[model samples]
Target chain A: MKKDELKKKRIIWVIWLVILIISAYFVPFVLLRGINQVEASFLYWTVFAVAAILSTIKITTYWSD
Target chain B: MNSFYVYLALSIYVLIGFYIAYKSRQGMKQGVIEYFLDNRSTGGIVSALSYSATTYSAFMMIGLAGFTYSGGVGALGFELIYLAGLSLVAFFGPRFWLVGKKYGYVTPYEMLGDRFQNKWIAIISAGTACVFLIPYLSVQLMGIGYLMNGLSGGEIPYIVGVIIASILAISWAVIAGMRSVTWTDSLQSLIMIVVSVIILFYVIYTQLGGFVSFFGRLETEYSNFLSVPGPGFFNFQTFLGLTLPWFFFSISNPQVSQRLFIPKSLKAMKTMIKGFLIFGLVYTLVSVLWGFSAKLLFPGLQQADLATPTLLGSEHVPLLLGLIAMIGITAAAISTVDSIMLTLSSLIVRDLMQSRDEYSDKKQLRIGKFVIFIIAVIGIIFASQQLDLIATLSVTSSVGLMIVVPTIFGAFFWRGATAAGSLTSIILGAFTALYLQFGNLSPLGLAPGVWTLIITVVSFISVSLFTEAPKKKANEFLGYLDKELEDKNIL
Candidate 1:
């Protein structure tokens, strides 16, 4: 892989992880409060977990070394 | 509800466990590398299963379900946050593997000691790990002890369960070290996961009337449980405090961190990462649902921890399935305890005793084996006391270990991280964790975990800037990683 490519890829993955984690902490408590259904927060977290797992799989899929 | 069934199930499990151990050691060699690391040639699937088994414990069924029972949906988020933290492994896995292979490091502490140009780094890191991890070990034993006693309707003594776990953990580990542990871990991981999945589906479908019905019941009666701060258990600061320490668990916990060095190939490492994530996801959902089922079925329980045992003993979960689940939970605790013993043993030999000029590799292995026995004994004694402090220590262990995160990240990313700074952060961070946790002081409504991270980060950076770093070693270490990050085309 090119040095620039590796650098960019690393930055992208790091940003994705930060955003994902921060959202997991804040979104359910802050944004989902007014949503009356309990499944709203529950479903939101389930979606978040699946997204994180998929993101990780994507990040690692191309790994070679 | 008879203890005889528990003993019968365990007897079969133990026999199968020993057979696997014996087979794993068939051609196993003598010496530290072979014993501690399985010669660093473990495959992807076995690595994934063992990693899963070692990471998720009895806490999943009993404690996590209890958390969900009390705190609601936030419990799922708390664990999912830890699951997401495995991203650290993706970033740092290759670096650890390359460095470990190059330096012939047996423990992550050994890697830390060498990277910082300070042997004391290894000693203190290892010492800190042993201190925090023992409580965690004892808690694992106590889980099995209590589970057996409870499952038998009080036929088995609590101490009997504790001793059984310790004896089995030591026996399997000593049989062939990593080989025995990983192989049996793979088997137990399968039993834990498959049985849990089978029974979870059965309970949810039959008892709770399936997914839609289960969610409908919770949504109608216990709606708050589906969200945060439900019944006021997981407020934002509380969640942050608990999750922060665990988010870095992949690196902070030495037993898990040492796993970065064991894959036979880079590809195998990738497989391990992906495999563990999938397993974690399925297992997390299953455990969370289990908790929710208990919340709906038996909402009048006096204590939240009674969720799992109550569910198991109720008319809901079948007798045979419950017995297997008991063994499954037991397997979960033993697998975790098993890995910790081996990792602590390796750290003791590599970080503490390696400096002795007369200590040969064989002798080092000998002492390492002896240390496992000693650790098991101490664990039994501490857990046998059932002190509030032991449970407290286990829960807050990640907080203390989180102090090592700054050193770990700096060692790889920055060249300015110094031994003095590393030592300062570890020592002070640990003290800060101890004071706040024991005193039950949460300054400004922030958790001890949050404060520990804040202090450790501040100390590590400030101390490094003020002190002299081992610049030469840092450059070589970072430079090598820079040049050799596993080029895909070549591989």
Candidate 2:
């Protein structure tokens, strides 16, 4: 891999990251509906808990040295 | 017995922390790296405790009680998983330490940039971090004002308390950077743990007669306090959405990453993890007890955030009550606010504006302090508005971080992911987060963040596959990682 190619790839990777962030604007709307406030809050936490656990796994497996 | 004393005691704590920072400035390096990251020489206990204190702040007081008040015992269930997050950190901390130490990595952005060799990754990351962290710090200040006024019988105006607390937070946090915040956080953690335990015991022994008696009383007064809410709390999309993004967030968030950068050894990392696990469990139990006890003591109350303080006031013990009211909240607000300020300063200086040329550490420290001052002012303005602490933090941080997850993960694990793919995923995810957070429109009656995460994952994968990946880019980024981690035998 040449230096130019590497820089270009880096730019592309960043662009991809931005797309993911923009997509997040729609997450809560999709999951929270027809639920009571208590139920909704609980569900929000449940997703957070699961996500924390999964991120932990991903960090362990893939975080490069 | 008034808010004056609470303010006085908090002032003393701030002074001690600032003194530590002033003294340590002599031993620090003359570069931005050393001032902000402390040259990665932090020990296990300090790193672990600091991380815990930063993560568990005023929100625990203002928000958690309100949650329990509104949701019953189900609120406790949320914190139950916090231990799992700590354990994950414990396991990951050692590895991160090894890499950070070997490569001289200072900020979370450094890790992403080094891994992907992408400058935009670092820039966007730092931007997202500041957006969330600055507002989050404001919430802590608001908590302090709320606590001081409540304890002082409304003697201290909320604005005055906010001003005093904000000024101190910036002083210690800006001066010492991580060096000061870490030590202050350690002491704050000790105070919080000791005071919480003491209060818990006092309530058990005096209020309810004993631990056993308290348990018995709880059964009679609020038996459902210990039980989980029924399937009403369990919707498929909601549950998954709430829990799944956290997995992405834990690994992706810069604040957590910054903690992992410290730790003197693998053993120190392990101990810190173990300590937080214990603390997390105990903290959850105590908070739940405190919250439910509020319901038992105050039969008719609309605002749940006041439950703990109200319970303390009911006991008729002035000094102990004042201490609980003052220190309980001081522990949460000061510890959290300072860390956020320090973290924000680091992001701006170390991550965003880092110069390639050799620079004096003193000069960088001065610049960092200036940034802290600006952030403190912004926070004061933000907190003056009435907003729920948890909502404020979630709006500012969680959604943005949730979007960053897939791209961060891909950068580390997926060789096929492209630069374009990373940017698109981040933009989409952030937009989705904002939409879910405040939008009027919805699809299938589900929250937008969930849809955001789902789409982010799919888009990231789909884009990587369909588009031609930077052929030489993968090897180059991997090459950088190999060089950075290889010397320490980390890879």
Q: Estimate each model's TM-score.
A: 0.98, 0.81
Against the hidden true structure, what lDDT does model 2 obtain?
0.64
Model 1 has an lDDT value of 0.89
Interface RMSD of 2: 8.9
Q: Give the range of the ten consecutive residues with the poorest summed lDDT in model 1 chain B.
A: B482-491
Report the TM-score of candidate 2, chain A only: 0.41
Q: Residue B473 in candidate 1 has what lDDT?
A: 97
The deviation in Å at residue B298 for candidate 1 is 0.6
| Each model's lDDT | 0.89, 0.64
The digit string of per-residue lDDT tens for model 2 on B78-170 reads 565444544335233554665566567777776666555566766777887777677767777877887777777898889888988888777
How many pairs of residues collide in model 1?
Answer: 1
Give DockQ per model, in order: 0.55, 0.05
Q: Candidate 2: where is the Cα deviation over 4 Å?
A: A1-65, B23-26, B90-95, B230-242, B245-249, B354-363, B387-396, B440-442, B468-491
